[model samples]
Target: MKKFLIHIPLLVLSTTFTFISCTSSKNVDTNLPKDIAERPADEDSQKYEQAQLDKLKASIESESSREKCANASEWTFAPMGAKACGGPQQYIAFPKKMETTLLPRIEEYTQKVKAFNEKYNIVSDCMMIMPPTSVKCINGKAQLITAEQ
Candidate 1:
């Protein structure tokens, strides 16, 4: 009974320390996004990760092209990727019919890219990407068109 009681506090203390170690803390650079890993990915690692991202983006594209688009109202654009300076790197146009599956996957990809950018300390041009004023269908494909505001 005495040994069990004595070890209970030690176990609690050890568990508390373990939990604290795993908890996420605020990063020193408030502007920087949170990193996915403890250390930055090496060059080769970054390349491989980028390849994987390309594959994911390609899959999203393939899924987007599954249906032929006609009406502009049938299409919408989703922001893609995280720019180093903040905001999405660009936007992707897809048919609204696939919104249920496409939006979630796009979000997943965006988050992964954001984490990748943070982990690899990616640098991007601080160019502002404005949202499209409307979507247009040309050559049976959806395209985002921006009008001068």
Candidate 2:
């Protein structure tokens, strides 16, 4: 009877150990990629990510330039000059008549800026056009008569 009791406890203990070991082994991790050759290709994914970043940068630049244009107090009719002008009094040669080409371009640019602003939810009082009397031509260059002038 004593031998039977001791054998029964040993049997139960061995059964418990077997169950624990089986459960632990089931939780082992074995699905990890074993080598670089087994990994997924990243080249195409990298290019796609770079293109998206470039597009975002371009949008930001466009928005920034539009905001600057909207905040500008005066517009100049500068041709044969840098794509962008600086300062209040600097001037560049005017290539066409102000009433036709220059005014139209200004209007077009303003409309574009307005549309961009509306799309991006930017708030500003831009696109204010100065009167003809506010314009002055010197050495074939047209400039706005700023307050300092």
TM-score of each: 0.67, 0.28
Best TM-score goes to which candidate?
A: 1
Task: Go through the candidates in order and give the C-alpha RMSD of each one to the true structure.
Answer: 16.5, 13.8
Looking at candidate 1, the ten consecutive residues that score lowest on lDDT are 24-33
The TM-score of candidate 2 is 0.28
What is the per-residue lDDT of model 2 for residues 95-119, given as tens digits with 9 covering 90 to 100? 3323354444444444444444444
The 10-residue segment of model 2 with minimum total lDDT is: 80-89
Report how far residue 26 has shifted in candidate 2, in Å: 34
Write the residue-wise lDDT of candidate 1 on 20-96 in tens digits: 87664633457555776645567569778998899998999898977777999989998988888999888889988
lDDT of each: 0.86, 0.44
Model 2: lDDT of residue 39 = 78
